[model samples]
Target: MNRLFDKSIVLACCIAAALGLAVDARLVAAFCLGVVVASLAEIAQGERARRASEAASYAYIMVAVFAPSFAPFAPLALYDIARRVRREHVWGALGAGAIFVCALVAYAHAGALPARALLLTAILSVAATLLSLRTAQLEREQERMRRTRDELQERALVLEARNRDLADRQDYEVELATLAERARIAREIHDNVGHQLTRASLQAEALRVVHADEPGVAADFTDVKRTVDEALQLVRASVHALNDNATDLSVQLERIVEDARSDGGPQIELEVLAEHAPANIANCFAAILREALSNTMRHTRAQNVIVRCMEHPSFYQLVVSDDGTGAAKTNSRGIAEGMGLGSMRERVEALGGTFTAGPRAGAPGWRVFATVPKQQGDDAR
Candidate 1:
């Protein structure tokens, strides 16, 4: 609109010179000055400037029409008014154009100007108004298209983040279930097979004592007792290995931390209070560890991270902290907005536990802590 208004000023000057050549050059100069003054208001930035410009423009059109020489520039004035003036005030432009026509016709009839010149002036005014409306329509359409493209790009990014969260959750669930099953099987072997082997070894020892005087029988019984003891040792060792593998939370966390450092990620520390923990709690803690590591790497600019898993008599707790500019500034919105941290909170809450995350107190960092109740099932014992 501003560009068209500027161009219209030049066009108006040309039209005034061509039509009013015989009139005093002073009147044409006056019309040019009036248009420039009105254009100043039209091209202004804010609403107040535009409204003041509109009043100035109306004054110019009303006074200019009384003289036949300045009459040709009326349409150019109408064009500027239509483009810059709001719709509610559009009647002002139409009324001004009407008055210009009536005055131009009266002047022409009184021999102030030719009939053909009046016809040309009316046609130019109508054409200019129509052209201004078309330009406004094209500009509105372009703005709408730009907004739609931005919205679609934002939606695509949200969907991609959700898909990744779902994939990670699914993998974590599968791994936890497998670990639980292994722990269960290991318990059954230790309780049933381990107990029977102990009894067999005890009976063989008694037989060796009773047959001590018979060389062949004593030697055979001694060999049986030693073999049973060795078999029992192997079974106990196997059971321990299975249990260790099932709930190796410390080892698992350390590996994750080490891998991150090796890949040029953050400096991380892992601490484990006990060598063994309940499989269910350990599994959940491992998931929490993986997610915390991921969130820190992806979202924070922290240089150092600390991950700790500690087991008590009745509960197990996991804490992941980082020395980054924490999300606590945004409060709940920061922790709840993202899928990764939100899911971690959900997992902890579902297990009847407490989950908390925010800026570390009196420090420049974020802290995530969760404590899950210990379940007294086979794995727990």
Candidate 2:
């Protein structure tokens, strides 16, 4: 658009110059011919054969010098040539200088204008060329700055994404370390303190047996034995609690799903939304899920399985479902007591949770659902 406006100004100047002199049909035709050829050359400046366009533009300027009325329009072609020249193109510089000198000579020989008019035209043409060169330089600088800005923005976005991933990795590492420490603590208690308590209980039992003939002594020893046994039970319970708490439900479920996938099992999707589930609740759900998946893989020709564990305000729920025709057949035949379904039911009922397993009512699949009241699960633990 800027180039077009500049060309328009040059054309207007040419018209003004022609008006100052006598206008004739020949001069008008020459002016029109020069304008059409210059416009075509400008339009083709970026084509593969742009050298041809440049040659044509230079040729038109040389021809215009003989038709003095069209001489003023020569600057349009010179401006394009000046803008296109690069520092590396030494031949291009020589060609442009030679064309300018030739045009000046042609004008001088024509003898159609006074020397003063000719000199003014020469000065204007030089000024126009220099302006074109400066404008082209500014455009190149602007394009370079734009590319640099885009590259920097792309790099900044990449760095920001990496920072977010790093932050998430750090958080996962911290959780894993905490789980490891808890497991270590549980092992220490079971190996050291729990063993010691068990030994004390055994020694008290032996003493009670040794003093069985003396009722009073036996009674005291028996009481001591009972106390030691109670202490041992407490220690075992604490160890079990620690071990349960050390388990991350989501991680365990993910490992199970990944293992199943690797073993050529059906596609399995597991989602655990119980972020802060209690140890006993988590343990119950994990055990049930393992058994449920085992049964599905063994008894059903399932193509897709979905396992979801969710925590509600008053209860925690787990659902394992699979899409398979075999499930409905199994349901119709009646699930045998020998199957793992009995064990799943026992685990859920022990925690005061409801358990149900059957073919879906309207869907073509099997669903095993269990829900334990939050209060009962915590109390059971």
Candidate 3:
């Protein structure tokens, strides 16, 4: 748009100058025609068509040289040639120089034009050419700068995303480390302090038995034994609480899903809604899920598996299902009992939970369902 406006201003100035120099209507018409041809050549698309259009524009300017009065408007075509010559085209530069020489020769031979008028025309033509070349150079520089700015913006966005990912990874690692530290503390307390308290309680019981005949001494020893038992129970509860708090059920589920994915096996979707499940319940469910997934991968040609762990007001539920034809075959061949199904059932029943594994009743797949009541899970813990 800027280039067009510049060309428009140059064309208007040339026409005004030509009119001031007393150019006739015929010369003005020829100059406008040459300008129109040069503009068309500038906008031409293909190589061959552009070259042909340029040739036609040059022909018009050469013919206009005969009228000498058209000299003021000659800068229009020279401007375009100057821009093209800046591309380092040898033929274009030679052609432009030849045309300028011919026009000067014609102007010098025309007896009506003075030396000063000829000199002014030459100066005007050179100024327009140099202006056009500078404009082209500036446009190239602007385009290069624009591309560089866009590349920098893209790189900045990529780096910002990477930084965000790094921050998330750091937080995850910290949480895992914290959980591991808590578990270690709980184990240390149970192994060292718990054993010592149990031993003290047993020693107190032995003293109570040895002094059974002495009523006062036996009573004192019995009281000491009871106190040690209570302390041991409190320590045990504290250790259990620490271990439970350290267990992140959701994180464990996610890890299981990630491991399944890394195996390049069936696509597994796990939805764990049991946010505050007991540690025992969480461990039980995780074990069941791992076994279920293993069985699905090993025995079934399943493309998709879905595992859901949900906590209800009354019970916690775990369901692992797979869309595979192998379920029906396994049921028919009684192979489900041999594929770790017994272990899953025993784990659930030991916690007073119910377990079932078979083909889905109303669906074309296999479903493993287990539910442990909240009361049972708490008692187990």
Candidate 4:
């Protein structure tokens, strides 16, 4: 709506005015001359914007200045009047008013040529100033929108960061509980299944020794031996299943690492120091490994990784490190501080243990050392 009443629109109406005024070809010539001159001024300014307004404003001003006393077209006069509503263009109307006044005064007793010149010049200057004000307002609105867009983008980034942090913390808690449960299951299997199998094997051996002394009991001894063999097979299969399940912890750790790495792929090295570690200790260490690996991949620029498992009398310790820049070198979350030191401590303490994760004392990378106690459940007593 605003654009429709711009200086260019006024200029078009002025052309019709010039035609209707029965003004000589010279006046039409004057309108075209003003257009070319204003366009060159706009070009010389090197702004490229508001060309239509510039041309029209100058043309309209010329007609307005010359029209009142010289019989300007009614439509062109109305166009200029409409432009006064534009806040910046109010001044253009003022200038046109001044010129129109002067023209009326001068033409009353002055030569036609001088009267036309003074009236048009005043009107032209007024139009140009008003158009410039409109252009300024539009630019201000555009700048305001741009600022709003930038601020929204910044806020979105902050929200995304907080969301990611919460997700990582939730994952850490879930993995800790999983490790504890696996340890409990392991204890149940070893204390019950393994003990019963050892007792059956011992009984079968004793029966065989008796069979050697009594031929009549030889068949009974053979059956006892066969039963022992079947029991042994079942025990072996159970152990194998436990071993298969053991690998699941490692797989889960790798998945966490992958999430941390996101775009980059993480390479993990897992080491087990105690092959017969208590289920609780082993599973806890596996969870720690996963968390450390995730931090390294997500935050560090380094690539290579090493996980070391150390055995103790009543506890197991795992130290996960990477060849990357380590925690101290970078301020942003590096391997040692990726999930945050507080979360790491919680994981170890949750299992009645202690954990320390940080740069390896002056070493090139970071390390996480978690020590969890060994406990027996239903069968230990």
Against the true structure, what is every candidate's RMSD?
13.0, 8.2, 6.1, 12.4
Mark the regions of model 4 whose C-alpha exceeds 4 Å error after superposition.
1-8, 16-22, 33-143, 146-184, 215-222, 248-381
Top lDDT model:
3
**Candidate 3 lDDT, tens digit per residue, 1-381?**
656766787777666556545556776676767577767866889988777776765666676566676666677777776666634685765676577657777767865455665666677677777778888888889999999999999999999999999996787678778888999999999999999999999999999999999999999989999999999999999999899989888767777777787566778898989878888888888888888887787777778999888989999999999887763557542675764888899999999999999888887667899999999998885
> Which residues of candidate 2, in runs, are more than 4 Å off?
1-5, 8-16, 25-46, 87-89, 114-117, 211-234, 244-381
Candidate with the greatest TM-score versus the true structure: 3
lDDT of 3 at 39: 79
Cα lDDT, model 1, residue 244? 65
Question: For each candidate, what TM-score against the reference?
Answer: 0.56, 0.56, 0.66, 0.43
lDDT of model number 2: 0.77
Candidate 3's displacement at residue 1, Å, is 6.8
Q: Estimate, for each residue in 1-381, the C-alpha lDDT of model 1 and write its tens digit.
A: 545554565466446444634657755675576558546754677878877776666766776676566666666566667776577776777688778878977886797766666677677667767776777677778889889989988998998899898896676567667767878999999999999999999899889889889989989988998999999999998987788677767656665665677556778887889557655566667778888777777777788998878877887789999987645434533654477678888777767788888778998877999997776322443
Ranking by TM-score: 3, 2, 1, 4
Candidate 4 TM-score, true structure as reference: 0.43
Tens digits of per-residue lDDT for model 4 on 230-299?
8767866676455445534444554555455544554666555555554445556666666666566667
Candidate 3 lDDT at 314 equals: 98
Which portions of model 3 miss their true places by more than 4 Å? 1-19, 23-71, 77-97, 111-121, 254-277, 288-380
Work out how many backbone clashes candidate 1 has. Answer: 0
For candidate 4, which ten residues in a row score worst on lDDT? 69-78
